[model samples]
Target: MTSIVGYARVSTRDQNPAAQEAELRAAGAHRVFIDHGESSRVVDRPQWLACMDYLRGGDTLVIRGLDRIAGSEVMAIEIVAELGRRGIDLRSLTEPAFDTTTPMGRALFSINAVSAQLRVDTIRETTRRGLDYARSQGRIGGRPTVMTPDRVEAAERMRAENHSYAHIARVLGVGASSVRRALGAASSR
Candidate 1:
């Protein structure tokens, strides 16, 4: 004897879950859990956690749509796999093809999940390559240096004349550490 459990969610507080609840009830769901003003990106929704706790091994978890459970394609894949591991089947009221009980539905889901993962990997690789190219072209990122060659020369001369690094920094309007480092590098050379 398997029971049908349902979960519903809305991303914002202003939106209502009435229509989704009605649909879930109409779909023969024995009990429906709901979340308001919650994002699907979060794995620990109060209603979702309650629904999971209420679910048994011989049960089907129903949702109004895939987007209700998954914020992204990667999340959809991970959630479906987790449900399968828990011996809980997933069904979508709006999508007949979203029935995990069928072989065809499982195959379609696998294809979609793999494609989404590939898209993410490709984007990451492209970004890495672009950054590497920029570095090779001498276009470094972040704030530019304030230590000019002239400043280094002046700081070195001041140090040779027994002037303190702090005094040199105050005269040049730069950091004492910068003056010290410049003088140290000149000494090292």
Candidate 2:
């Protein structure tokens, strides 16, 4: 007999999985597997792996939403395709059109998956091009360094006066490690 298995995931430990579990149970899930503090980007989540292992051919895999199973469009497509290969059906409680029990649903899902992947690929390429353009214009990204030239000069003067790294850092309003690193970098140059 084919069974209905449920899978749920929460990104943080502080989040409660009770609501998801209750929804799955109400949806007639014979067994439910949950992963707490697990990111959807990770395919090797402990409970997810166990859920995949426990599933058999003809079993229906149910989830509250696609985001519970995948972090990206590529990941979601791969999972849905894998379910098809395993002779298991996928049904999303929130996304009725994603039910792959019928031929129409499967076709529509495949088309949507491809569209989603294309959008993701386009966005990534556009971002890459924008960054490249900025670099060509001599612009740099990321946060500015805390150790400026003036700070380095002051740190060196403080060190030469035989001040402790902790004292220098306190006076400089930075961390002890920052003072040490600045001094070390200056000496190296």
Candidate 3:
């Protein structure tokens, strides 16, 4: 038999999920799984995993809101698509258009998924452009290298003296890999 299963998540232990659980129950959910102190971004949330395991084909997964299930539009689309693939339906107590049991709802979901994908693509493109601009400005991102020019010079002298990279790194208080890379870069120059 098909069942209506609900999942709810709260980011902090101080937050209560009773209100969401109550709403899911009112919406005909036979069982509600709640994850306290779990962020919606975490797909491995204990209660959410349990809920997914408990659900069967033809089961309807209900949520008070999409935010209870996903942290981003991409995540929401992925979860909805997975449900569709598993022959499970999704319903949002607050978002009526998200009910996948109806043709209109399914159409709306597809539109929303497309919009979400566009937003993700736009963000990715914008970030790439920003990084390219930064590169043009000679500004590098990520952690600064610990190997200084002086260290490189010293490492070279040590290497000339037949010292191992590990020994040079120990003297310079840096990783052997960093010492090797600094020497390698200096040699290439």
Candidate 4:
């Protein structure tokens, strides 16, 4: 008798997993593992890893969708391939055609895999173009700076008066790391 296991995850606690759980139960899953507040990008999720450990060659693993297993298409395909190599069956409730346990299912899975790969490639290309454009425009991509030259000068004066980094940051309404960086930049010049 092969066991059927279901895995469900939501990236935030505010989201409900009730629908996914109901679907898994309706599909006759013997056990269901739920992970809340876990990002789909993270592969080290406790429940997900535990589910993999509990599965055997004859067992089946079910998920709400490919995105539920992994945030990225590459990651989803890799995980699905790993399961196939282990002789474990994968069933997506949302994409019932991707069983991978039957010939037709395998073909369908192949199509989905190719589609996922294309999507990832397109996203990567778009991101590269966007970053290149931003770089050419001389726009910084990360968080905006919170300190100005005046703030740095005031922080330097405070530091020269033997004030602690924390005190200087508090007085200037900035962070200690900001004060330190400002001082470092000043000294380097």
TM-score of 1: 0.69
| Stretches > 4 Å off in candidate 1 | 139-189
lDDT leaderboard ranking: 3, 2, 4, 1
* TM-scores, one per candidate: 0.69, 0.66, 0.80, 0.73
Ranked candidates, highest TM-score first: 3, 4, 1, 2
Q: In candidate 3, which residue pairs clash?
A: none
lDDT of each: 0.88, 0.93, 0.93, 0.89
Residue 23 miss distance in model 3 (angstroms): 1.3
Task: Report how far residue 13 has shifted in candidate 3, in Å.
Answer: 0.8
Model 3 TM-score, 2 decimals: 0.80
Clashes of each: 0, 0, 0, 0
Candidate 3 residue-wise lDDT at 185: 88
What's every prediction's RMSD, in angstroms? 7.6, 4.6, 3.4, 3.4
User: Candidate 1 at 101: error in angstroms?
Assistant: 1.3
Instruction: Tell me the lDDT of candidate 1.
Output: 0.88
Residues 1-189, model 2: lDDT tens digits: 899999999999999999999999898898999999999999999999999999999999999999999998889999998999999999899998899988888988989988988998899999999999999999989766677899989989989999999999999899998888889889999
Candidate 1, residue 56: lDDT = 82
